[model samples]
Target: MAFFKSRDEKKSEEIYKIIMDTLKNRGNQVYDLKVEFQEGVVTLSGVCDSEATRKKAILCAELAEGVKKVNSDPLLLSEAAAQEQAAAVPPAAPVSPNPPIQTAPPAAPSVQTAPAAPVSESPLETGFPSAEAEAAELKPSPEPQPSPQAPETAARSAQPSEPVQPQAEMQTYTIKSGDTLSKIAKQFYGQANKYMVIFEANRDVIKDPDRIYPGQTIRIPPLP
Candidate 1:
């Protein structure tokens, strides 16, 4: 018995044909090109001649009717193609293995030090009084005085100290495609129900919590 193709299968086949025809018309050479279609998503796998060709193939697949998304991660350039691209770029200049050595000039000759003369014998040993001893005998040392302590003010010590309150910290996040207030709240506060916190903080920019567009900057307030 012969089997018939289902409605979904036929639709997938049509999408695949459309993508293949588009790629062919664009003159993109993709070796071993394979197209997998499911639930409006197309996945491409194969070797391309170059990165530009691969991108073109993916763009063609995406532009096809009934194609919601295209996965081109499996599409890559062949080894030969990669080598050709590498050859097109010039190689960097080679660095020298050994640099030139800089020699310093000879240092000036060291000067010779003259020998010190012999010291004479002390006056105390020769039974004559020294000048320092005679001076000390003429004048006596004065007594040392103590430093005074600073007085503390009674009015300054009786004042009470006030407590310091911390300021609230906020962060700004640019809205990306498919981002919602609840999703942002879940990312920052780890709870989807805390989306109101963000909505209240971004009242100037975000008038409605459910309505947000890409590229709009919103403030994210810290949770209490």
Candidate 2:
């Protein structure tokens, strides 16, 4: 019997193969796993042994080219973990057959308190002054004023700062045949790895660091 598949199904199969290959290469086992793709959405479902394997499978699918979104079904723990979890749960306590007897509430006793006797105030001594009079007698001295030197410091700070000199004007280099970014960087900055500086400066002109053509002028930024 001949079986026909649509273009979308073929694409989905290809994507699934790539994702499975990538996961296998990572040393993660995907048993009974199924991957499906539709309109850039990728879904992964099936049984796996460990949570790590399940998550790694999903991540691998997500990283696959053209994968817009990744959806995964809830992963079930392996049989060993399920058994361990089952063993961890305590069994329910046995229920009593006979109903508990109800008890009557106890009555609260009345409490009696004796009346308090009136208090008499003692007259203040004539020799000692009242609290207000004592507070008025003791006045705090004023705090020392800020030093006049602050004004001189302020004046110095107010003075215009020295103008900063601009970094050496950006230099340019016309790319020649057989010239690489590393070669150009070594020629200008004495460090081949510093080619990134030139690439960053001339992103508008140079799109790829590995590829530069002749007659393309690129900016060479000043060294740190």
Candidate 3:
């Protein structure tokens, strides 16, 4: 079997270098950082001075051309650093008071007149006669019943159901006595240089692309 496992190892090394370079270029310290690569995903694990640094690391990984995803679940910010960040920000300025409103001068006063006597037949007070009679007349009528919601039901029924699309099928192969990633890629995707795709996908199980032995299962992603 043509064995060449260094393809995966070399790829991992290159990805690690790129991640480190990106972190450095973005002003992140990588002394405590650990980078892992698998199936097109980059995992960043480390302690950062602040959440912003952690986010910057993830952003740098995302900006890398071949990275499909960045996992920062293992990244953390120091509690003291978080508290210090909160304490360092200055408070907002106070609001200014509004100017006083100007007003017109007071008008001259007039003489007051005596109150008039109440009329027994006034509409508001006594026209309806007894209190019960007035209350009966003033009682509000029953509210109208709401219309049936057929339009809403019809609108819901008119909505089209989304079609279900099948997920892309992944292929797997058991290594033969004499097989290389390049041969497998050529066999599956009509290109040997594209072996990196297979190596990346199977990095979890295949430590070295050139060293896989017979009967070892390997994933073969669909041709891009």
Q: Against the true structure, whose TM-score is highest? A: 1
**Tens digit of lDDT per residue, candidate 3, span 51-99?**
6677777787777667798888887767766687778888879888987
Angstrom error at residue 203, model 3: 99
Question: Each prediction's Cα lDDT score?
Answer: 0.81, 0.77, 0.77
lDDT (Cα) of model 2: 0.77
Q: Rank by lDDT, descending?
A: 1, 2, 3
Better of 1 and 2 by lDDT: 1
RMSD (CA, Å), candidate 1 to true, equals 50.8
Q: Listing every candidate in turn, what is its Cα RMSD in Å to the true structure after a full C-alpha superposition?
A: 50.8, 50.0, 60.9
User: Candidate 2 has which clashing residue pairs, if any?
Assistant: none
Predicted candidate 2 versus true structure: per-residue lDDT over 1-224, tens digit per residue = 99999766776787668757876787766667777778888877776666667777777777777889888864455786557667888999998799878888787776777878878888767988889988888978689997766877899988987543323668888999999999988887666888898899988988889999999988878866
Give all TM-scores, in the order shown: 0.36, 0.33, 0.32
Stretches of model 2 off by over 4 angstroms after superposition: 1-4, 81-224
Question: lDDT value for candidate 3?
Answer: 0.77
Count of clashing pairs, candidate 2: 0
Clashing pairs in 3: 1-178, 4-210, 5-208, 5-209, 5-210, 5-211
The digit string of per-residue lDDT tens for model 1 on 1-224 reads 99998765776567667756766887868888877778888888989988778878888788777889988889889998889889988999998789778899899899999989889887556577789989988897887876644445555566575433322688889999999999988788767888998998888898888999999998877778
